[model samples]
Target: MQNHTIYIRTLKRAEHTVFCVEDGQKTYYDPQFKRMLPYASGQQVKRSLLDSFCDAGNIKISPTTFYWDFNKKKELKEGEAFGTCDPTYPDQLIGGWMKASKGGGSRTLKRRSPLSVSAMKPLHPLLAGVNKDSASFDRSGHSHNKIIVRGEDGKELNEDEINTILEGKDRSLTRKWIPASNKATGLFIQDIAIDLRRLFSIRLDDFEPEISQEVEEKLRESGWVEGENVFGRCLIAPVKLREKLIPILAYAIINWKITSNQARTFSLMETLAVSIGGNANKIAGAIRAKLSEENSEQAIPVVEEQVKGIDTFVTPTAAGYVATTTESIEAMDDAEEKLIEILSSYAYEALPEFAL
Candidate 1:
């Protein structure tokens, strides 16, 4: 709600007042979006422009975001201020280059900054119901506003069609975590209908506090004092980064299936443990003990012969995470139906309202 609600775009000398953008580039300039050059209606300007703007496409187009600032061409005295909002201000300015594509594009609210609006809180349409006072301007209203939009993805939208999405007319849904491959171009990975249910029930502000806390803890735990905050959020400490390489060598052995190597046994165990979300030391210890237990009989060798490494399966760029091997991802996908079936059974078990 604190981003890009009201904008003040700069205007060229004689450009048309209204127009629709295509993937960041303005095209077929018109009256709906752009108001009369120096004089125009803000409401008519919004409606007409939005009508042609949204629809028939996917993925949000980086818009020729509208601004209201008019540069004073009149000669200014030495100490005169041109205007409260100037074209020079970063928020109001748009570069000469950059295309604005048209269509049904996503305008996902990614990040937000602490910006203040007078009584008017410039916000997303989804925010209208939450604060209607300053947002709604009737008879005795002061109409000062501003908006800042950034995302050069160059997709356009048609507001007429967008209304259906906001209106809840299309109430049917897609599942949560539907995967990147299944999503439509402009559609987010999670289906909106499903995801909104979570939003309605969750406190969004606290959703990611652990992300920052964990990264800081990992940094301090590593005993690296300098640049601690700098690299706090990375998965692993910067100094211990090379230690992650130990897993790749261990990974090589797994793919080759050289289970007899006793020295690398701990490494292999540690590597797999990390894969399944366990600490390295705990995994190494568990692997050694498990191997020893299975080898109690003479027929069962202490060396694990069946443990084959799938190297070509994945390419590891960093140590902390495994970029899924096409082979592994494929194998997982093959069994995904069963995996989801199992997961779906347990999905609601631990969820809130289970007792109710």
Candidate 2:
């Protein structure tokens, strides 16, 4: 098993101590810090001050933070900083930071690569802004040059900004490569074409009669017609007709074009809405609030008017029939069914397949 070390910072210390969790307990050991105070178990500390003890992963200043030599390491002083030397990379290596042309700016850039020492040519014209590509003379006489960089918006950049871009920490402009999985990419072309043909069948049902006739005529004119099966019909359709069908199918799915079940569900929801003062949200909330009470008999008349025919019972009094409480098993079951239809419609409408 691999052991992970946790680094923690103290309020007064400049350096952090390392610790690890073992057997559900955390422990630390550091000679310097231990000289003042020693480590303890969780039971020894109070719960109120536990947050301070568990605080870790904070960055701090120290000479050991950077590499001072090939093998030796040292921390930077309070006022000190570290950076790459004059010859930042290998002499033969191409592409790195270089100074800009005269009068362009005092700062360096990482735009263009250095030229070979043998194939000598004058870069004066380029420096004069002929093609926006030029080279700067290095004091070390090395054949390496810096690449000029621009900001994310493609605007001109300064040295500091260009260096940040070269560091490649920001990946906003980078395209992530997704590897093809066996289950998806391994499908045969013929199989995929068949599935797409079935999908096209589902899509084509939404087209208007006139539009479908027009598409059929166009397909026949282009030497294409409906095949024996959906997949065959899909294969038979011309590219132009296929293109025409896409938007129509997309529109139908997006707007949820009047299916029988959807129409019935909408009617039921509308009926409920009208019965309970024409606001579903307010009515649902009111129903829930009223049902939560110990004796909700009084709230029955208002709710029953909405749910009676759809999900509850209608009681007939001496004068006329009236809707009463919806607390009964039959009424509850009916409400549940209606509510399911309403919720399913909402959920289906919110799906990406129905999105415009």
Candidate 3:
């Protein structure tokens, strides 16, 4: 296996070894020191840590924890570290190189046979910045970039200060790519026209007002419509529950403690994220916290059941939703798979073969 020593510094402290060596693409991150150094990658990490490992059918996407540890007041020395492929993915690849002093890694993974080096041009003004499309501080969901700002005891500065470091003077935080946050914010926020047209779109046999009077009456009673109609047929909107409902529900799901079950954690963070906007989550979380504190029995069991019902791979269910405009968000995940397939097959197929 090829060995490379990357200099890992503590910014204000002395340097030390994070690991000896192993397999896979691994980096040593001392959350305390706020530094990340290349520890190892590929098969080097995998074979060293994992026994009886295999990557059959190419099912696993090995994005594992390049693990390390730190005491509240002590430094880390040569330590053991490892990562697994995505846990959801079954079957593992024998990653990293096979030969000790030669080239080999991921025999199962076809080395990127780059037909020709090419630059992927941006669809917009080609502005470069950090991307930030996450709900939390890069804790989970998609692995985004994070700047580990070490405090006296390893506490990071508040998000606003960290964001300021990332954004500099750009007041347009929404449009800015925050590299420190490791988010994909620079992706052009396309013309609102796209979402607007989608919003106003009409599909076949979806909702017809004239054919439905009773429905309108129900909506009226639900406090959804406050507008006047030309025919005085003020049979207007439903409670607009879907917009703010699920997020608020998800907020309850997140902070709603299930002390009864002793389940401090659950999958609501990802499964519910699809429908819950940040603002709604924030509001809902506050409300849920209040409600949860008041009633012990009702709050605990309800949260446990809600969490148990979630499917991170599928769209989450919420209680109060009556109308929705989007397609199966499954479209998003499918498109990702399609993109990867296209890149691996069609994009690379025409490339000139590489050296042996």
Candidate 4:
């Protein structure tokens, strides 16, 4: 039988420890509680310890399955390391042709799942000339838009509550793209959730790998310089590299979008549709489709027209790849969808996964 393990996380320091038993017992002695406690799989256990542990919050425990490898060895400073038998990593024979030659690198095994597309937050390029405030203006570039998030009780939220809602308990779930209108003193704030989904639609799969690699090398070389301050070890880069690299970076993003596997997740596909559309009217249609109760039909066209004004300031062509326009994104034809799916598979190849 496979082994199951439990992890106890201290509330105070948020430190975690692992525990396993020889028998398949459901209970264990908790050092914090100094007593035995019942536990179940997938449930969180929280309890207070003795006075010595007062500095921390109640101890929390979660049960999880453990994978291990007995045959392979790993290098560790203090002791020998071991591999994991997690399903995320599946071992397999090398290709049949390579097996005949006994190629050293022929046999391979899956190591982990790819990272979530959202995990590439740092890599997502900032849109050109589209500052936070630009999201608020009508198509004419007038500041007339905002996003309102109401509480469960339908009451307006205070700044703190708004922050809490936007930056939820799980920070990863929080929205990454924030528009300027959200900072204003009105009901409208940036709709980050929608923004994140829209990001999936920008088609970057066709971006030339060689060009991207060259751009990265050039940016790293030119963007960094040694400087002197309190110490001689300071390095400098712009707070926003958008101004310097926006032309190339934005072009890359406009061409990248979610792939087929990603589209399998219906919500992701819809978000890509809206983001690619880049038109408020189209996005509102997506919103209406996703959330039938809400109607964004009126507000969307205004925002769409507003963004069109920026066409003069931010022309997307850079490198040889042309920028994806709202109309192009909105097309959602069979060919486009197929291309997005294929590209998505390529993108997923670049991420790592873990078993939970």
Q: How far is 113's C-alpha from truth in model 3 (Å)?
A: 12
lDDT of 2 by residue, 95-173 (tens): 1123333454433223122211111111111110111112333334444544445667988788787666659575323
TM-score rank order: 3, 4, 1, 2
- List the global CA lDDT of all models: 0.21, 0.24, 0.25, 0.23
Number of clashes found in candidate 4: 24
What are the runs in model 1 whose C-alpha is more than 4 Å off? 1-68, 73-356
Worst 10 residues of 4 by lDDT: 91-100
Please provide, for model 4 over 25-48, each residue's C-alpha lDDT reduced to its tens digit, 9 standing for 90 to 100: 234344632433322222111011
What candidate 3 gets wrong by more than 4 Å, as runs, is 1-94, 98-264, 268-329, 344-347, 352-356
Error of 1 at 132 (Å): 56
Query: What TM-score does candidate 3 reach?
Result: 0.18
Lowest summed lDDT across 10 adjacent residues in model 2 is found at 184-193
**By the TM-score metric, which is better: model 1 or model 3?**
3
